[model samples]
Target: MPSQPTLAFNRDHIHPGDRLCVAISGGADSVALLLAIHAANTAPRESLGVGLSAAHVHHGIRPDTESDADLAFVEDLCIQFDIPLHIHRADIPARASQARETLEEAARTVRYDFFRSLIASGHADTILTAHTLDDQAETVLLKLLRGAWTEGLAAIHPIIHINTPNQRPGKILRPLLQTRRTEIEAYLHALNQPWRDDSTNADTTYTRNRVRHELLPQLRTFNPSIDQTLANLAELAREEESRWQAELSRVLPQLLLPGKPVRGGGRSVSTAPGHSSLSIEIERLRPLDPALRRRILRAAARQLGSRLSFDETSRLLALCGFLTLPTVAARTGASLHLANGLRADRSPREIRLYREKQSANPE
Candidate 1:
C-alpha cells in the first residue's frame, strides 16, 4: 500500500450553497479529486461547505471494452460514495468527422457542452475538473513551443466562466491545479482506491502525451524542478495578463467607436444590412505605441465576435498603415476576410471590422 498523501483542494471560490459537480474521467487525477471532495464533505473541518455530485463523459474513442470499463469503474466509484452521477455519452469520432476537428478537440467540445447543459438545467452551478500542476506545466511548455502570445502563456486557468446568451454564467473550477500527479496517485493508493487508465494517454502521437513523456523528461535533466518553474511562469503570466486586461478596459472606450451608421466629415460608412461592425480612427490608432495598437485591434475583433491571430493582427496593422516597413503589401481598399465571416476594410480615416452577411445557400 502506498503511503498516505496530503490532498489539497482549493475551495476558496466555492460557496456554502453552491452545487458542485466533479468531472471524473476514472483517471488518477479526477478520481482522486472526487474521493478527496467526498472525504472533505464527511469531515467538517476540511469541508468545502457545499453539496457535491459527480459527472462522467464517455468519449467513446476506444473500443467498447476499454470505454465501457472506464464508465463502469466511475459508476461503481460514485455508487460507493453515494454521490449522484451525471453520465454523458459522446460520439467523439463522429463529432470530429462532422466538425472537422481532431478526436481530442471533439472530445473536449462535447464534454464541456455536457457540463454547460448541467449548469443550464440547474443541476449544478459550478463544475470542478482535475487539472494538476503537471498538466499546467505541460500546457505552458506547449504554449511556449508554439510561440504563443503573453496571454497564451497563462495556461490552465484555475477558474473559467462559461457565459451563455441571456443565462447566468457558470464557473468551471480546477480545485487540484496545484497538486502534482504523483501526489494524486499517492492519495488514491492510500485509500486502496483504483483508477482507470486511458490507452490514448500513452500514445506519443498526441502532442500533449509527447510533451508529458518525452519533452518533460528531457527538460528534467537540465532542471530537476522544471515543472514547478514552468507553473510559476504561468502564474506570473496570468497576473500580468489580468493587469493588461484592466489597462485595455480603460483605454478601449476612448479609442473605439461603434460600427453604427456614421455620416460626417464628408464620409459615409455603414455595414451591410443586419450586420454589425466596429471602427477605430486611423489617426488615433497610428500614434499609439505598437503594443497598445496591437492589443486594441485584437480587442476590437473580439468585440465583433472574432479572435485575431498574431499574423492576422499584424496584417490588420499594416492595412491601417501602422507598419513602418510593411512585410505584406497593404493599401487602401484592401479588405481582409477572416474566420466566422469577419471582414476588415481600411477606409481613408478608419479601419472597420464587421462580419460579412452569410448566404443561406452556397455552391
Candidate 2:
C-alpha cells in the first residue's frame, strides 16, 4: 500500500479558498482523487476551506448504454461523497464534421470546451484532472518515440492555464500526477469504491494502450523505477523550461519593433511609448544567446497567430542567415511566411516583424 502521507502531501499542495472542480470519469484514479479530497477536507487539520464539486464530460462517442452507465456511476459517487455534480454532454460526431477533424481530436476539443463552459458559468474555478504517474510515463515515452524536443519531453504539466479563448482563464491542476495507477487502485479497493473500466482501454488499437500494455512492462523488467525516473525527468525539464521562458519574456521586447504585436496576439510591450509594429534589429539580436534568439523567433511566429513546429524553428533560423546575405533574396523570397498575418522582413540593420490585415475572421 502507498503511504497515506504521500496522498496528504499531494492534497496539501491544494490550498484553501480554491474552488476545485474534480474531473471524475468513473475510473479508479479519479475515484481515488475524489475520495482523497473528501478525506483531506474532513481531516482534523482542515486544510482546504474552499468549495469542491465533481464535473464529468460525456464524449457521446461510446454506446448510449455504456455512456449512461459511466455518467450514473459518477453521479452515484458524487452523491456518496456529498459533493455537487455537474454533468455536461457533447456530441462528438457532429462536432467532428463541423471541425473537419478526426474523432479523437474532436472529442478532446469538445471536452475542453465543455470544461471551459463550466468555468464561465461559475461552476468551478480550478479543474482538477486525474493524471497519474503511469500516464506521465506513457506520455514521456510516446514523445520520446516521436523525437520530441525539450518542451514535448516535459509532457503533461501539474498546473497550467487552459488555453481556450473567449473564456475566463482557469487553472487546470493535476494533484494526482505524482501518484501511480496501481496505488490509486489499491486506495479504491481499500475504500470498497467501485469504478467502471472503459473497454477501449484494453483494446491495443490505441497507441497509449499499446505502450501501457506492452512497452512499459518490458521496460520494468530492466528498471522497476521507470515511472519515477520519467516523472523526475519531466519535473526537471519543466523547471528548466520555466526559467528559459522567463528570460525570453524579459529580452523579447527590446528585439521587437517598438509597436509591433508580440506573438500570441498581444502587444509586445505594455508600457512602450508608442503602439506600432515590432521591428527586430537582427544585428543587435545576433550577440545574445542563441537559445534566446530561437525563443524570440518562436514568439514572433505566435504573434502572427501561427505556432512554430520543430521544423519551422529550423526554417526560421535558416531564413535569418539568408536575410544577412543579399544574394539569396533573388532566389528565395526575402520574407518568411509565418501564419496568422505575420511576416519577417530582413534588412541590413534590423529584422522587422509586422502583422498583416486580413479580411477573414481570426481564429
Model 1 RMSD to the real structure? Answer: 2.9
Q: After superposition, how far is residue 17 of candidate 1 from its true place, in Å?
A: 2.3
Q: Which residue pairs in model 2 clash with each other?
A: 257-278, 257-279, 259-276, 260-276, 260-277, 260-278, 263-303, 264-302, 264-303
Give the per-residue lDDT of model 1 (tens digit) for 139-195.
Answer: 999999887888999999999999754496899999988889989888888778889
Q: CA RMSD for every model?
A: 2.9, 5.9
TM-score of each: 0.89, 0.81
Best by TM-score: 1
Per-residue lDDT tens digits for candidate 2, residues 274-306, read: 222566656676677777777788776666466
Worst lDDT run of 10 residues, candidate 1, spans: 260-269
Stretches off by above 4 angstroms in model 1 are: 1-5, 44-46, 164-168, 259-274, 329-343, 358-362
Which pairs of residues collide in candidate 1? none
